[model samples]
Target chain A: MTTQQLYEQIQQKQSFLCIGLDTDMNRIPEHLLQTEDPIFEFNKAIIDATHDLAVSYKPNTAFYEAHGLKGWHSLEKTINYLNQKHPEVFTIADAKRGDIGNTSAMYAKAFLQDMSFDSVTVAPYMGKDSVSPFLAVKNKFTILLALTSNEGAFDFQTQQVGNEELYKKVIKTSQTWESSENLMYVVGATKAEFFKEIREITPHSFLLVPGVGAQGGSLQDVCKYGMNDKVGLLVNSSRGIIYASQGEDFAPAARAAAQKLQQQMAKLLHV
Target chain B: MTTQQLYEQIQQKQSFLCIGLDTDMNRIPEHLLQTEDPIFEFNKAIIDATHDLAVSYKPNTAFYEAHGLKGWHSLEKTINYLNQKHPEVFTIADAKRGDIGNTSAMYAKAFLQDMSFDSVTVAPYMGKDSVSPFLAVKNKFTILLALTSNEGAFDFQTQQVGNEELYKKVIKTSQTWESSENLMYVVGATKAEFFKEIREITPHSFLLVPGVGAQGGSLQDVCKYGMNDKVGLLVNSSRGIIYASQGEDFAPAARAAAQKLQQQMAKLLHV
Candidate 1:
């Protein structure tokens, strides 16, 4: 989906929530475990319940990967389900994949061409060649790891390299690359206070902000400083929604959790 | 495997070769395409041919992930094959996964606990919390991306934040963490000259070096500066080895490529 499509969905749903499918097989209800693919069964139900309420579904690849081959099959089934049934919901592979040129090219082909995720998170550690491979595909995005929410984010990310913080410099310098027009970034909701500074660097690009619900980040605070005119924020909540309950009512609990956020998002969008 | 184990492997095999199983489906022989899972078929043949000749097998997760379910299954089968068949061969899931405490714990469980890979490549972008989670696991190594081979690695990695290069500070500070003994680093072969400085900070730790063949890095130069007394270098050749041939003789061709590197590594170890 295009950024415009994502923007339109946000406007239509009166929500800016991106339901993170950080699906854990062991965490899900035991009933799901009986299914052929428990992760897929849970995801299908969550997507079915929360599709209209969410602008996107961000599946952190680590979750599927944890279960081995079965997990990957679940991911494929879930993505295929989304494409077939709920095309309006954007998809983000919360996979921080970045390497050198040829490797990155294969990575780009893997996620963008093969799996067909709308966007994939990329680490900027290796710089433009690593990130640019993802941008080579049309309409897809390379969401660079800018200002993260984790504690260690303060290590080198916020440190002053020359004149500006390293994260800021990454954003500013990355704009020079080709296909950077399609570039978004991962600016954690915990770092919402720095959203203004982030905006000064890449005002128009979207930010895939995690660390909201279970991580104790405030939605209002994120919207206060992070939201653009285009509603360029995919605020993600994974554990808080997907694993809200470990019972058979997990899907409803998932819905309720997503609904509470969507309701808050509705108010934020002034629905 | 520990650095000690890796060192012994280098001595036993008379090589320091780490053949990267970056199995791109598009690049593999067309005959394998007839199979249900071409990636695994190609990898099985390659591993069968070169397992004893080489010490390590590094599977770049992107190549497996690109094919989605099939890719992941291939990864599982490949690793299981190694574990069951050649238990002595060191395995690495070159996934480059790292996050916050809770998330990193999940990632560790995914790649290390749940899956049977010996190590997982982690991006230290989030600093201590993100990286520490990987180290928390016993008997598993966290191969941190220290200095990569790509053109854009200089964008931030080589920048002097205070008195030291960002990569150096990361290496130095990483020593403060628990299970620092298991921490290996990825210092690209192209940056062979930086080995002197890197070794000064991390003398005992293993370095998983890439960028030898397809990226124009010299084996002689890397050994001259990078090799420790333990022969502590897991020099990776991905595309150069795996995609050595596109014909039915791909496995033999890969064996030849691996043999060439193994011979060079034997010399490097002796010197």
Candidate 2:
């Protein structure tokens, strides 16, 4: 999906919400376990119910990977289902993958080309070579980790890199790389205040915000500081939205949680 | 495998050579494509040939992941083959994966528990929460990227965080995390001089040094500065060993390449 297409989806849906499919088999409804692929079943239902309310779906690959081959199979099925059912909705393989240049290209192929995700999250620690591979693929996106929401964010991301913070340097330096026009960033919504500084470096680039509902980040504060004319923010809510209920009505319950967020975003977008 | 066991392997083999199973389908011999699982077949041949010479096998996951589900299956088969055939040889999933606390735990499960890898490489960009979970796994290793072999390493890693470089701070701060005993550092052989400073921070921890032959780093230089009393270095040579020849004698050619490295390591070990 192109940036303009994603922007238009946000406008049309009145929500830049990216629902995270961090589906854990143990956490899903007990009844779903009887199915052939419980993870995919749960994701299909959730996507069915909430696809219209959200502009995108970001499946955190770690959850599926935990189950091994069966989990990977579920991931393949989930992605296939999404592409077939809702081509309009953007897909983000929230797999935090980065390596050497050649290896990074393989990851780019795995998520972006083979599985057909619109974007895949990448760590910027390896710098341009690691990130540039993802950006090299046409129409695909590379979401670079900036100020992540976790406590570990303070370890190195926020440290002074020269005169500026390390992540700001990441943002500024990454913009000069080949095909950096396709670059986006993963800025934790928990650090809503930091978004102002982030925007100073990447005023136009889209930011995938991941700490909204469960991680105790304010939507208002994130919007106030992070929003651009293009609504350059994808506020992701995973556990808060997907695991809204553990019963048979899990899908509908998820829809309610997503709908609430969508309503809030509608007000923010004045749609 | 525990650090003690790893040390014993190094002593017994008189080589810390890590054969990188970066098995690309296109790069392998054309005849291998006739096999049911070409990637696994190639890896099995390489492993069978070089198992004695190398102390460890680091399968760069991106190579397998490029082929999608079939590629992932090859990874599973390759790891399983290693665990079954060469139980003593250390297995490192060179996946370079890291995420949030919960997600990191899932990745830990995927690589360590599910696949039974002795270790998995992780990028340190996300900090403590991302890395700590990997450390939580018993008898498993978290090889953190301190200074990579790529040109992009200078992008953020060499930049000063305070008085020290960012990679130095990564080495220093990571040592303070919980279960830091299980940690190892990935200080590239390409930056052999930097290993002196890295050792000053992590004196005893094993360092997985890539970029030995194919990427142009001298083993003698790395061993001179990086080796501890335990010979604390797993020098990886991927293309130089694995793709030594693309013809029918590829496996034997790979064995010869690994043997050459092993002999050098043996001389270094005074074995």
Candidate 3:
């Protein structure tokens, strides 16, 4: 999907919300366990319930991968369901994958071309060749990890590379790579202040912000500093929305959780 | 597997040679495509032929992930085959995966506990939390990307963070994380000279060096500078060995390729 299309969806929905499908079998409703492929079932319900409110759905590969072959099967089913049922909603395979040149191309083919996700998260530690493969895929986005929400972000991300901090360098240097226009970024919502510095570097690129509800990152602060005129942000909320209830009304409960955020996002967009 | 056990395997085999199972359906022999699961069949043959010649086998996850469900199944079968048939040989999942704290735990479970790989490669861009989860796994290793072999490594890795270069800081900073003993470093063979500076930081930790044949890095230079008292290196060569012969003689050809590296390693060990 084009960035313009994503922007149109955000405008129409009045939300740039990217609901993360970080689904775990153990966390799903007890009744769902009796059914075949509980992960897929739960995701279907949530996506159905909140598809209107959310512009995108992100399934973190780690959650599915934890269950091995069964989990991977669920992931395949989930992505297929989204594309088949609701092609308008952007899909993200939140697989933080990167490798050397040819190896990275294999991942690009898997997620972008084969699996047909609108985007896949990539780590920039390996630099250009690792990331360029994803960018080369036409009409797809490669969300590079910049300032992650986790406590580990301080370990190296904020350190000085030269004149600028490492994350700033990441945002700046990536712009010069082949097919740099297709690039987006994963900037944690927890570091709201850093968004100002990041915006100065790449004003037009969309930022996938994780850490809104459970991770304690304020959505308002993220928008206040990070938002472009196009509302260039994909604020993700996974656990807080999906696991809102373990009861039979879990889907409705998930809608409620998402709706709450969407209302706030709508208000933010108007402001 | 423990560091001591890996060292024993290296000494017994007289090779720290890590043969990468970067199996691709398009690249394998024509006859193998006739089999039900061609990738597993190909990997089984290669492992059977080269088990004694190499101390370790690393299957890069990107190759498996490309084919989607079929590819993932191949990875499962390949890892299972290695654990069952070649139990003495150390296995590395060349899956450069790292995420937030809990998510990283899921991947660690998938590869280290569930998949039962001896070690899984992780990216350090997210900092300590992203990587430390892998280190927390009992009797398993977390091979962190220090200096990769690709042209992209020069982008951010070689840039000065403070007094030291970024990759050097990666090697140094990772040592302070919890359960750091379980950590290993990936210093590419292409940057053979950097190993001397890397060795000064953590002399004992094993360095999983890639880029020998296919990427053009010197084995003698790696052994001379990167080798510790315990012969701490698992130098990997994927295409150079696996795709050595895409004919009826593929397995034997792979063995021959592995044997050449093993012989070179043996002479390096004696020297």
Better of 2 and 3 by lDDT: 3
**Model 2 TM-score, all chains together:** 0.99
Tens-digit per-residue lDDT, B1-271, candidate 1: 6668777877899988888998877798999999988888999999998987899999988777767666677888888888899888888989887766766787798788877788999988889998888898889999999999888889889998888888998898888888898899999989889999999898888899998999889999888988878877888988888888999999999999999888887777777
In the order shown, the candidates' DockQ scores are 0.73, 0.90, 0.92
Q: Please state the interface RMSD for every predicted structure, separated by commas.
A: 1.3, 0.8, 0.6
Clashing pairs in 1: A110-B66, A152-B126
Where in model 3 is the C-alpha error above 4 Å? none
Candidates arranged by lDDT, highest first: 3, 2, 1
Docking class of 2: high
Clashing pairs in 3: none
Ranking by TM-score: 3, 2, 1
* Chain B only: TM-score of model 1: 0.98
How far residue A240's Cα lies from its native spot in candidate 3, in Å, is 1.0
> Against the hidden true structure, what lDDT does model 2 obtain?
0.92
lDDT score, residue A182, model 1?
90
